[model samples]
Target: MAKPASIPGLNPEILAWARRRAGHDVATVAKRLRKSPEDVRAWEAGDASPTYVQLEKLAYEIYKRPLALFFFPEPPEEEDPEHRFRTLPAFELARLAPDTRLKIRDACAKQIALHELTGGRNPAERLVFRDLASTPDSDPAGVAEKLRDYLGVSVEEQRSWRSAAAALARWRESIEEHGVFVFKSSFKQQEISGFCLYGEEFPIIYLNNSVAKTRQIFTLFHELAHLLLRLDGITKRDDSYIGHLRGEEREVEVFCNAFAGAFLVPQGVVRELAGRGAPADDEIKTFATQLKVSREVILRRLLDRGVVSRQHYEQKAAEWTDDYFERRRKSGGGNYYNTQGVYLGKRFLALGFQQLYRGVISRAELADVLGVKATSLDGLEQRMLAGTG
Candidate 1:
């Protein structure tokens, strides 16, 4: 059996961040930490203690937060000192599993700054949101097609899937007043990997700026689902399981998953292939290669559609995971998503950076908002001007 994950006595700040990041309640963490929930609470509330070694182990598991995050005394404020991106002291909590941490930090950054960036609700806006919420019988497939057409992209002509997705996002920019940009950050202290926040105006999806291309592609589709559904919230999870969902969030998750599935690889085509008869391993591989998506994604869709039974799907997924990673490792280079540069498309980055450059926002302010340096902004501005950023 696998060894159980341990937790040390965490300080209140670190404990609180860990609990929230892991989405584990106090009682649950207490069990993992080998203490009562109340004991864990006291430790988080500054009333009790966990030893240093214990803290280290606990920090390692929950959000992969560093022991220093717990010991830092005063945490960094939410806003970054440079004003490029929101200053995130809790970022250290994200360093645990790099992929997972990046995803979580992306979510945290979105949630923390969404309100300020999106601003107060407009009266007309609420009605629009209400209408969108109430709108029924809306065809999700049609929505996907509409989005595709709006972007002036035909699935047939696509070479780079990430580029196609970015183009779609760019098209989305023209219709909405708020800025959309692909954001990336190396969250040193964070434990999770990606997240999203639907703002009153601009809804941002943050990806763990540290992961490979295939994963980023999934994260992008996942966040885009959040945008389409118009839900406001944050999500932090590893791809360990499908997801941990509850309340309205579950509905959104379903929608997003559906949207991603349909957008990345059309369901009808997948269903048709599966209907043809039992697909060989090479067939699955060929489909993944043609679609330019991870094989695991292809299997997941097949499983969801009942084209493959649970046992078969799980086995195939496992095999695909091993093969995919091996291929990636052997390539000795970046994957599609990573090579695509930032997760956000260049068009949105240009728009977003310009919004800051035109003196609408001070350079310093822009830097802090983006979690980049002023010098970096200078380079970004030049890149945007060149239409290549």
Candidate 2:
């Protein structure tokens, strides 16, 4: 690119933002840009100016703000009154997807029209989750780095599935720019493991009550991938199943899968554990055990990386998934997803109760907050008090 004529004027705000966003010393940017650090500092201080060519290159490489932001006087940041991150009442999300919480309010505004048309049924409530409904601008690689930093776990941190789940919790905690929530309930007759409520603070994850501990862990990560992709939608897959979608949803799903795979079993770490070479079926199982992920997940990863074949992966994965269901059925022939919901939901409810008793809120209101009957809250309170006393 030809360097343009030196411009007489430049915006200080633009240079300052680049300095802060890069989080590096002015000297560093100068060295990389092959300019004197003093000049860089002067440019930021609005004492020196860069040519149009230099400004264009700087704008593209760092900060990524449009050239207009530098010149235009920025209006003060307007904060939205309804920040979705705040805790909302449970009735607001009953059987609803997280992403549509905002829309749900709008629907309520048209309640008379909607109720007259649908006869008091709100099917859209259940369909509009936030996790599968977001629009993320960053790529998977960028998201992976953000997740690692947010969770405070290194890409090299290979641990148990439980530990990985804990890491996911940290990731949720790290998300300040976006909203996330865990929606738990004893969903009778529904086989849903969990769904994301995309683009809402109160994103819903519907955990099924009937799933095994191992399977539930996988579902947690799978739904999390939906969140990263900002997809406002639903996804159901058997263990280690890669979605073969097309179009916009396909792009997001692919990115989600990549994020989940990296978070669960980082490529570099897995490659090292595989002895820097492909391992056999038995060896892959051993690796899975070591990684604290399902054998199918590991096998698929290996196969995708050319460490295994389609035939080898499917043959082994089918056996594992089949035997898994068989063993689970033998122990208790119940819906796996529903079972998880009840167990985890009870725990979450307990926390909600404590928040109530502390006078942080009213008992009736707390029940309302969680979408449970007042009688249910009273019963749970008695049980909790009895157990403690």
Candidate 3:
């Protein structure tokens, strides 16, 4: 066999930096690259270097970084994304899955690119809730009211949507109308519900599509609370960690949770429902159905208002949680284009398509941004356009 040619002047530190940045250990990288662990260690330790083809595979395929980075004299000083956002602690944020981190980084890059493409122009009209005067000590119900008004989506309007999916679409559109871009992706991890990337020009919210639509609705508002507060970071709303958080971190979570619940199921509506007497499981379901929220949300509200006992609330919550996951598992898969539409979001796709049409970005670049193949661009564009109609 012919020997592969080597690339001179490759920095071993850069190779190590890329691997660490992708959250991959030497063993994992070796497995992915079909190389021995010793070989991977040798390459990183400057004892041996990869050939050009191996370097390309390592850069683009394995680490998902630019090939040019390998030539840098030293590892670039990359900012900790969590530090730029006050929503979560650095340690907690670092615990996210590698794919989740990459998705976030990609989303942030797209946002920055969009901002630059548009010449840094701000949205013509500002979101009313963008300047909300609520604090951690502020009334959650009042804050919810303000957000509802800003969104201009009434409970009657929401109920009239007739289905959870429809209601989610309506709410997402309304929020996007106010200049925020919402995207969905399957985190493939249960702990992370959703996250937001706060930006002055174009803020972004990401929902985990693997969850139930009702749960996604709650996540939408939860992330809205983050954007409204101008905080950015990933959110893992797993109950196990809630009790461990303290101070501002805990307060932020509590406030966002309360605001999301209150925004979806208004306090007055909960009070009125409870006035009829303690709600049964069916009644809770009915309330959730009417409000277009998850039963878990309504049950929490009931527990807070003394309408349901702690034991009853916990039992119902556990049952609903289990049922939700089972349904998710049994629902099987959906159409690829449809799922991609939901994942990329109409607003973000529209922006990308517009850029393509204006010759600001090439079709190849558009495909890259949309995370689809160049050949798939035509159909994706058609689906996106048809969706807008």
On lDDT, the candidate that comes out on top is 3
**Candidates 1 and 2: which is better by lDDT?**
1
Collision count of model 1: 46
Sort by lDDT, best first: 3, 1, 2
Model 3 C-alpha lDDT per residue in residues 39-149, reported as the tens digit of each score? 989889988888888899999888888899999999887755566655565566667667777777777776876686567764537664466745676777789998788
Ranking by TM-score: 3, 1, 2
**What range of 10 consecutive residues in model 1 has the weakest lDDT sum?**
80-89
Predictions: Cα RMSD each: 10.0, 21.6, 2.6
Tens digits of per-residue lDDT for model 1 on 7-30?
343346756765665545777677
Assess every candidate by TM-score. Answer: 0.58, 0.52, 0.90
By the TM-score metric, which is better: model 2 or model 3? 3
- Error of model 1, residue 370, in angstroms: 2.4
C-alpha RMSD of candidate 3: 2.6
- Counting clashing residue pairs in each candidate, in order, gives 46, 36, 0
Model 2 regions more than 4 Å off: 1-138, 155-179, 184-192, 238-244, 273-277, 332-351, 358-365, 368-389
